[model samples]
Target: MKGIHQSSMAVRSFVVMACVVIILAGIKTASPIVVPFVLSAFLAVICNPVITLMCRYKLPKWLAIILLMGFIVLMSLWLTSLVGSSINEFSKQMPVYRAQLVEQFAWILDKLQQFNIHISRQKVLEYFDPGMALSMTTNMLSGVGNVMANLFLIILTIVFMLLESNDLSKKAHLALDDPEMRLKQIDRFLQSVNQYMMIKTLVSIATAIIVGIGLSIIGVDYALLWAVIAFLFNYIPNIGSIIAAIPAVLLAFVQFGPAAAGVTAGLYLGTNMVMGNVIEPKFMGRGLGLSTLVVFLSLIFWGWLLGSVGMLLSVPLTMVVKIGLESSQSGMWLAILLADNVDDKLSDSSMENHKQDDTEQISEQEK
Candidate 1:
């Protein structure tokens, strides 16, 4: 029996590994189409509440869906405009930024010279030169394809997702509706997803605002830009905050020198700490508790597979998977995939503390 159990465990492990390899291969091949579809699915989740509200109002579901789609389109366009404007502004100020960067680099080189430490500044210049030109930055922005086409694809997918929203839950119900159970599973899944995304979005936006204001007060040039990056990257756990802080701190160093840069770094780090440590856990609790190691691995895997946007969306995608897994009869396997490592530690601590309390109570009774 023991040998059979060990063999079964080994086979399970092999199957899991094979599945992971296949999924990664698929991501590489399918990212162009898959990225937009994933975005659409998440966006659909967010707007589902409004869709339900429209249905509740006795508006024909189709018309309500139309209105909701229009609203989403307008909002997407407005955000695009804001981002485009920021890009234009950043472009105009590139020369000044370049000069500041050179100045900062020179200061560093001077210190190194004083210490007799030599490093070629030209190599460093080549590495960072992309930030100097739009043409050069094409690699960063083009990603899978051009900006215009990517935007069109994303918007187009979103439209289809909105249009198909009505039939989505129907399909799920048709597939999963059991004689023993009613709509409870589906309802719980949707409710959990809606609640989790809402809380996540709120926390991210708040972190962005606080960090942005702090950066701006410290006289960081691209305060709004860094803030937007912070807001976007906040979706990624453990690593996003650190990545966002790098540019902000580098810019601060360029503009204000050491003292101001230190202050800027402090503010960014502190804000991230408060948000990640205190505020988020308070609101999120165990709702979407992805393991930190798993979250980072997903960020790296998806980011490589899809690009920067994939990294940004990784956590939400994983959360959706977790919710689906937990809600379905045959999805217990996926539940294990999404659970946090901290959960085990938390459980152990509670059990030990409970045991200690019980011992104390017994001692008191003896006394």
Candidate 2:
């Protein structure tokens, strides 16, 4: 009987792994279509609050959605213009930067050869082209354009999603045996996701503005462009801010030498330290329940699957998966494993103490 049970568990695990592999393959295969749809859904979640506010003021749903769409369009156009101008400016300066880079490499190679270090200039130059930064930026922005090409389709998707959001509770009632319990779980999930998105957005905006102003004051070229990059990259966890800082720091070095580059690095490090360490934790309050390892792994996995868009959405996507796992009796252990520094015994003890206090309070009130 024990052997049979063990075999059953092995088969179940295999089936689950197979399903996951198949799903990942399908996502990769259908990325062009899936990426846009997922992006639209993310936008819908972010904008749903605006729709709620408009509805609260007794506006028609259609009018509210139309206004929201208009706002989105305007924002998109402004961002497109900013990126366009930055790219133009960057292209104009690329030749100068490349020449400087070659000169710097030659100088470095000469200094190193004095110590009998025989690194080849050609080999170094092959790997570290100055235009590498510009090329990466161009590729990323072009991908953004491709994903956003069918604006009307994305907008339509958002419209239907927002309309359906209002009826989720009603549908939950019809679908679930324990409607109230299931609805509560769903509500908790949505609330957690919304809170995370809202707080992260505000923090990222603040970081971007500070970075932009600081870089501009320091005379960094393409300050606004770097700021926009910072804002987008902040959506990714852990190493994102560091990655965004590299190009600006490199530009500082190329344009104004090592001293200026040092200053630029300091500015980025300090700002990220303050915002990410001090402010974000106070507001987020252990709410995300994601470990550092999980966050980094998700970044790699999602980025591999969906490109930049995947990296940006990694944390939220992982959070959704974790929450779904928590809802299932058998899957709860997986969710617990993923949780950041969570101790099951400690958590159980805390719950017990809270229940005891609540019971005592009720008895006192009855007396």
| Total backbone collisions, model 1 | 0
TM-score of candidate 2 relative to the true fold: 0.86
Q: What digit string (tens of lDDT, one per residue) describes model 1 on residues 1-367?
A: 9999999999998997899799889987987677777766777777777777788989986787778777766865675566568777877876787777677688778888899988677755665542543343234334523333566566667667777776776676666654334445465566666777677678888988998788877877767767776776677677777766776676676677778879988887888788778986787676556777778888887778778667767777766666566556457556666677646735754675687699889999999
For all predicted structures, in order, the TM-scores are 0.71, 0.86
Candidate 2 accuracy as lDDT: 0.82
Top TM-score hit = 2
Q: Considering summed lDDT, which 10 consecutive residues are worst modelled in model 1?
A: 132-141
Q: Report the error of model 1 at residue 60, Å.
A: 6.8
Query: Where does candidate 1 stray beyond 4 Å?
Result: 1-27, 50-68, 88-92, 105-108, 119-170, 173-188, 320-334, 341-367
How many times do residue backbones clash in model 2? 0
In the range 1-367, model 2's lDDT, one tens digit per residue, is 9999999999999999999999999999999999999898788888888799899999999999999999898888898889888888888888797677667667778899999998976676567664676577667667777887788899999999998987765664555444545335456667777778888888889999999999999998899989988887788889788878888888887777678889999999999999889998898887677888888999999989988888888998888788677656677778877778778524853675687699889999999
* lDDT for position 97 in model 2: 79
